[model samples]
Target: MSRFRRTWLQHSLRAALALGATFSLGLGNAQAASTTKILVGFPAGGGSDAIARILAERMQIELGSNVVVDNKPGAGGQIAAQALKAAAPDGQTLFLSHDHSITILPMVTRNPGYDSAKDFVPVAGIATFVNAFAVSGGTTAKTFQAYVAQVKQQGGGKGVVGIPAPGSVPQFLVQVIARKNGLDLVAVPYRGSAPMMSDMLGNQIPAGVASIPDFIENHKAGKVRVVAVMGTQRQASMPEVPTLAELGLSGFEEVPFYGVFAPAGTPKATLDKLALAIQKTIAQPDVRDKLTTMGLSVGFMSSDELAARERSYAKVWAKIIQESGYQPN
Candidate 1:
């Protein structure tokens, strides 16, 4: 009917499309600017906190957003799990926990506040850490056999040993080793590793079980001695330390692991974004080297793989606990 009318209508459509594009761009930017908070279920200076801080630093730059690590420590991480359960499912918040908060806590406590299979979605695994049984330099035990000899000499075969917390991996390892060796180990539980080290140095505990890195430097400096490594293989940083398996204890390989978890309802898109960012960060040369030097093995597992790993450990730890006469309440 009219060329001018048709031309005007076409120009109007082009302008509308450009305006829609501009609006969409602004909305996306706003979404990206939203702060991402990661919850660490331990106090600062702990291993979990260290890992979360490292990952948070990389995530901030990789995701193009601000990220912060919020420490919520108490009740063996049940406090943090409850807080995470109440968090919105918008993928803005995540929980970084090791094996205790995920699998063991639920078994030991009546209520952990979050179910690993139902209330959370695994994002990515950061690393796996091997534990070590170490003693202060003043201890009479210089090696695993010597430790056994000292325990026997102590008359009751019940020697005081320190662990990070009750029902933690290190504690469980101590129980298992005590049973295997037919010794009575009165486990002394501490809030964290620092105090454990203090008591051990003060001779409050005759021996101690701790993470490999916690005493690695001390061992190297002749301040402490490692009796045995808990994992299957000797730690790379301490080749002289013998593994539990090598010491005639078969099937005692266990490592504490750290991974990222989101609220159960967090969208898959957000989880994928997080996993990608973690993979990129762990792949960095500096990050890899730093983690390795800390006596940790760099482990990058996908979400499915991480979940499977957790479940597998749950089954394994459950059996070990039961066999060790640990009646779950």
Candidate 2:
């Protein structure tokens, strides 16, 4: 063979191999893009985890990709929030949580590991849930007013109320209610709703404040009685219970919300795709029913709308926390 021809053939072989390698790398990137993960700050079998799983199933259908839920429960959702903050902004990792991790934690905790406004970009708002002030069936108080009178009559020092978490919305509400009504109700924080509900069922605590869903089952069983719900209007599930507004308590009408968020700097195109998928998922009749049955008021908000809502919610909680003079532990 001629030397020139031999050299040309060798160079041609090298170019072909390089081209094949590049094509294989491209396929890997596409596969990675096809998979998505929804991160939950709580363990499985809880409300947040259930929401994540439900959305993930529907999202997989809407997105035409494999979607999953990853639980990273710790530090009142700080660990999961931090993981998302440092994650690659590829839209694959999202945080599914409620107000505790997003709006209220930052206000009460000295450092919550991630800034809701700065570290994450809002993707969509899922739904809203109402908090309730409940008492054991064994209690003598038949109404919220009666409950207050009992607390005051028993003396301020003995008034204790159980809450799900220390820096949670229910805890702050307990403090605010006690101060406003001239009752010295002490706020007792528990790790989560499960234990708090258990204590309430055993009559270990006479009164407790938590999401209505957290106590709805027991309330139905006549194990506990929900005295008042904190929303602008009554819950459809518990229509007989009056709202804080109807009881003449202003500014207690705003319900806590659940939302999805991605790490900051996630591509706009990715965010839009996620938001659309979420909107579709929430619009499903069965999905809405499931959420409603689980105590969430099924609703939807677009990306931009959710962002604005978060800002407004944060501001409201900030004022409440400041007024209560709560210092983070």
lDDT of 2 by residue, 255-326 (tens): 788899999999999999999999999999999998898779988988888778777788888888888788
| Position 157, candidate 2: lDDT | 39
lDDT of each: 0.81, 0.86
Those runs of model 2 whose alpha carbons end farther than 4 Å from true positions after fitting are: 1-34, 137-140, 153-157
Clash pairs, model 1 backbone:
none
Top lDDT hit: 2
RMSD of each: 7.5, 5.5
Tens digit of per-residue lDDT, candidate 1, span 147-213: 8878877756878789877777777788877888889888887776766777777777777887775
Give candidate 2's total backbone clashes.
Answer: 0
RMSD of 2: 5.5
